[model samples]
Target: MTHILMIEDDPLILGPTVRALTAQGFHVSQAMDGAAGVQHAIDDKPDLIILDILLPNLDGWEVCKAIRQRSTVPILMLTALSDEIDRILGLELGADDYLTKPFSMRELLARIKALLRRVEMDLQQGRQTDRVQVRDLVLDLGMRQVTKNGVELSLRYKEFELLSLLMFHAGQAVSRAEIFDQVWGTDWLGDMRTLDVHIRWLREKLEEDPSAPELIQTVRGVGYRFTAT
Candidate 1:
């Protein structure tokens, strides 16, 4: 069962969200304030977090930034703040997704399902011993580690998935649409620029020269190809 940590101040929302997640076979832990929520996340190491913005003691954005400093656990922010700037700030603070108040329960379920599906796929792939390497770069799926010149590379969640998929389909040029479907799910309607941002970050980490990447080549007008030979 996937365990979730939810931090919210509103008693009404807190109860309903927990009950809903529990019904979906998820074990949930609740924290009424940001400090406790961050602590619970550290103690429980939950599969994901559902955090509220109007939290007392620390507030959601600060909690998110602090938690991200310690772990790369997936974060989904729930906020009454509906402004685009507020949403983007949450994302920049290391949140995987942001949902505004008055959101449909069905949509909430769909988002959770998509995130769980993506994580499960990546976890399953990480447990397999078979791996693919290109030049000095090594991807040991079983160990869930990547290495370049025998030095382990620390990649964010999305970065790992992007590299893993590229290596899995070595020579094929994967289009942006295909990447979106594979990583973010087919139903996701977020802007495509999100993918580009991640790709740019991934290149900076994996490439000797991000400006002129070699192993992971960007085919103009098409997509990206990982040549691991």
Candidate 2:
């Protein structure tokens, strides 16, 4: 059974959601505040996190940012219905997916299953390759490691995926949509911020000048393109 960490303040939604997930053979841990959510995520390392944007102590945005800095664990944001901006912001802050309020339990279950499957795929793939090098930088796929000029770089999973994708598309621009689809999967319903956050993170890791990155470039209203140059 997959273990899930869910952080939401609503008792009505939380109770039903927890019961539904438990019925489907998921082992779940629940929290009502962002601080607790973050602690539980680090301590328990749940398969995935279902985070609420309106959390107490720390909002989902802060929680996501804090988590992204230290871990690449997949995060699914829970937002209020009609809060499209919140959905987009959550993605920009490194959320892997978002489910608006008033959504069906069936949909949430499907998303959880998909995320767990992707996590498994990433772990399996990590075992297949310890490292991939392009130019002077090295990405250790095995340890989820990266190096710059022979020095190690601590990269989150999404950042690592960004680097891998760029290496695959070396010497050409890779569209933002392609990057998001490849990294987060096509089944994800979140906005394009998922791609944007990862691309930005990758730039900060691999580029000497993130503000004017030479490796990943914006394509001006289209998407991003990455080259080893």
Candidate 3:
């Protein structure tokens, strides 16, 4: 059974959500505040987390950052705030998916399943490659590690995945839609900004100068391409 931790303060929403997930045969855990949610995440190590943006003790952003620093567990954020900046901020902080309030149980369940499927696919593929090298960057596929010029780079989960995808398609311009479908899953409903944020992060870590990136180049209104020279 897949374990899911839901950190939501509102009992009205929480009760039905938990019941629905439980009916789907998921092992569900609940936390009413951000502090408790973070602690449960560290101690129990759930397969995925459903976090709310507003909480009593700590906010969801802080909780997301804290968990991300330690684990690569997939996170699905819930928020009443529909602002684009807030959504982008959650993605920047390492959220895998975002859902606004007044969401249906059907959509939420579908998103959760998509995320789980993506993680499973990555785990299965991890055994195929030992290492991939492009220019000065080396990716240890099995270990999910990356190094540039013999120096290790600290990359988040999505950042590493984005780099791996681009490196796999070196010398070819990969469309934004393709990248999104592969990396974030075909059911991804987030804005294009999520991909853009991850691309910026990869350039900052792998390129000597992020402003004028040579490795991952923009294809002018199309998508991005990796030039392995």
Instruction: Give the distance in Å from residue 227's predicted Cα in candidate 1 to where it truly belongs.
Output: 4.9
TM-score of each: 0.81, 0.84, 0.95
lDDT (C-alpha, whole model) for all candidates: 0.82, 0.79, 0.91
Order of quality (lDDT): 3, 1, 2
Report the C-alpha lDDT of model 2 over 1-229, residue by residue, as the tens digit.
7888899999999999999999999899999999998999989888889998898899889999988877778898888856666667777677878888889998988888777777776666543445567778877665667777889887667677778777766777677667666776766655656676677778877788999998788888667776665
Model 1: how far residue 76 lies from native, Å: 1.6
lDDT by residue (tens digit), candidate 1, 13-79? 8898889889888999999999999999898999989889989999999999888877877788898
Stretches of candidate 2 off by over 4 Å are 81-85, 126-129, 172-178, 218-224
Segments of candidate 1 deviating more than 4 angstroms: 23-25, 69-72, 82-86, 125-129, 189-191, 208-215, 227-229
lDDT of model 3 at position 1: 91
lDDT by residue for model 3 (132-159), tens: 8988889888778898888899999989
lDDT (0-100) at residue 33 of candidate 3? 93
